[model samples]
Target: MLLEVRDLHVEFHTRDGVAQAVNGVSYGVEAGETLAVLGESGSGKSVTAQAVMGILDMPPGRITGGEVVFRGRDLLRLKEDERRRIRGAEMAMIFQDALSSLNPVLSVGDQLGEMFTVHRGMSRKDARAKAVELMDRVRIPAARERVRQYPHQFSGGMRQRIMIAMALALEPALIIADEPTTALDVTVQAQVMELLAELQREYRMGLILITHDLGVVADVADRIAVMYAGRIVESAPVHDIYKAPAHPYTRGLLDSIPRLDQKGRELYAIKGLPPNLMHIPPGCAFHPRCPLARDVCRTHEPPLYEVSGTRGSACHFWTECLNG
Candidate 1:
């Protein structure tokens, strides 16, 4: 495994109360494989990624427990400097919003070149050249000219491409892309995803793609991990998940997607909002909105039970869910 997150827990301390943003989340990704962490907003998807990247804002947020094992070493155990070294050269993150993430004051060339200058000790001239190469690699046209452009000068999709270029500049072994196609049109979204997939194949990089759009992951993800209220409710190969979901939450998400076969019909939406992380209900966190939820779901928390050699579900009546 290139990355193995074991029983990860993250908490946020606010004046109101502590929010258990991530509760015992566990998942793994391998080199050249894409693991899609699927869930609604505030389901601990992005928080877990931040923790893995060592970018979580401490004081307000902290990794309370669990291990984030990257390669053979435990990332959580690494010193700050050691982790910083690994962050860009070994593993990189492509944030959701490219506009805000990029520095408004800096040119895109400078931002991309900084990785080479800082990590590889390349001279400014060489770094600038490498930045242009990265921009071209990501299929940004007129890369030489656009290299010196600011983030505001580019279109939304173009800005995202620049972000991808920056993330790939160092040719890291792992890439965590959090909602990489969030605000783009459907056409542009496909293009970005296809670009990522192509780059992943070329570099043989392990990818952790965090997104709430099931449609986006359907074509790109090798495996899917469905999160609800900070816990993984179902995990399986992408085909298996869409064909037959083993948890109610996963089923709800699938049903919520707009299907062409069901034209002129009302779109399905999951009932009830996601539970408050600060006050997550006892037992299964998704029970309040689960149609299959029963009395057992209200009291005893279900462990992730093996549904198959490659699948698991944290639902007591997983068998019923699968066969339903």
Candidate 2:
């Protein structure tokens, strides 16, 4: 495994109350493999990624428990300086919003070059050349000319590509992309995703793709983990989850996808809003919205039951769900 997150728990302390952001979330990604994390907003997808990257805002956020093992080492045990060394060199992240993430004052070249200058101790002249190389690698048109442009100069899709380029600049072993395709039109989204997949294949890097778009996950992910209220409710190979979702929440998500065959039919939507982390419901966090929820579901949290060697579901009636 290139990365393994075991029994992870993260909490956010707030004036209102302590919010359990990530509760025992566990998953792994092998080198060259893509693991897609699917969930609605506030499902802890991004928070988990932030924790893994060691970039969570610590004043409000704290990793209460769990081991984030990367390349045989527990990152949680590493010192701040040590973790910082590994963050971009060994494992990098592509944020959701490129515009906000990129420094407004810095030119694209300066921003990308900073990684080389800081990590590799390269001179400014050498770093600029490396920056141009990265832009070209990510297929940014007129890389030499565009390298000096500001982030505001690039289009949304191009800016996203630049984010991917920066993450790949150091040739990390793993990459965590949190909604890399957000805000782009459908065509642009497809282009960005395809480019990412191609780059991952070329680099053979482990990839953790976090998004709520089922269509995008279907196209790029090798395996899928469904999260609800900070917990992983189901995990399976991408195709298997699409063919037969074993948990009500996963099934609801699959059903909610717009089908080409059902053009005129009303869309299926999961009824209730996601539970607030600070006041997450007892038992199964999804019990209130689950169509297959029973008394057992309301009274006791279901453990992730092994459905197969490579699949697991956290629903009391997973068999019924799979069959249905």
Candidate 3:
């Protein structure tokens, strides 16, 4: 396994009581595989990413339990210095907002070359050459000249490319990409995703694609985990998820996707908002909005159950949902 997150739980100490941000989350990504974590805003997707990256706000947030194992070693057990060394070299993250992530005053070349300088112990001259190569690899035109430019000089898409170059600079074994194509046009989004997929294949690295875009996951993810109200509701192979979703939440997400085949019909949407993290409802978190929800769904929390050889869903009516 390249990365393994087992029974991960993250809680925030707030005035309204402890907000369960990540509740019993568990997943893994194998070498050369892409696992997409799918959810809307406030579904704890970003919080989970922050936890994995060890960047969660410490005063309010804490990892209550569980282990993040990479290559059979538990990351939670590592010293702060040890984990710091592994962050960029062994595992990297491409955050949602490149503009905010990049240092405004630093030249792009210096930022990119820092990976080489810190990890590979390369001289500035040599590192800059490698940086240019990486920028070119991510399809930024005229990388040598562009390397001298500040982040503000590039367009949104180009800046995103620069972020990708920086993330891949050390060729980390695992990458967590959190909404990497956000704020870009559709055309640029396609290009960036294609580039990410191509680079991932070339490097044979495990990828965890965190996105709200179902279209992006459809294109590149090998497996999919659907989250709602801070917990995983469904998980399965990508094809199985689209073909037959076993949870109402998963089904609702699929229904919300605009379908060309359904011409002249209105777009479907999942009604109501995601539950508040501070006070999630008892039993099924999604029961309030689920059309198929029964009394059992409102009275008791359903444990995730194996519905097929390759899929599982946390639903009392998985068979009903599947058959319906």
Clashes of each: 0, 0, 0
Give per-residue CA lDDT, model 1, range 1-324, as digits (tens): 999999999999999999999999999999999999998889999999999999999989989999999989999999999999999899999988899999999999999999999999999999999999999999999999999999999998999999999899888999999999998988998899899999999999999999998888898999999998999999999999999999988988887777866674676788889898899999888889999889999999999999999999999999999998
Candidate 1 clashes: the total is 0
Ranking by lDDT: 2, 1, 3
The stretch of ten residues in a row with the least summed lDDT in candidate 1 is 259-268
lDDT of each: 0.93, 0.95, 0.91
Considering only N, C-alpha and C atoms within 3 Å, which residue pairs clash in candidate 3? none
Candidate 3: list runs displaced more than 4 Å.
Answer: none
Model 2 ranges with Cα > 4 A deviation: none
Model 3: lowest-lDDT 10 consecutive positions: 259-268
Overall local distance difference test of candidate 1: 0.93
Q: What is the C-alpha local distance difference test score of candidate 2?
A: 0.95
lDDT of 3 at 35: 97
C-alpha lDDT (0 to 100) for residue 221 of candidate 2: 97
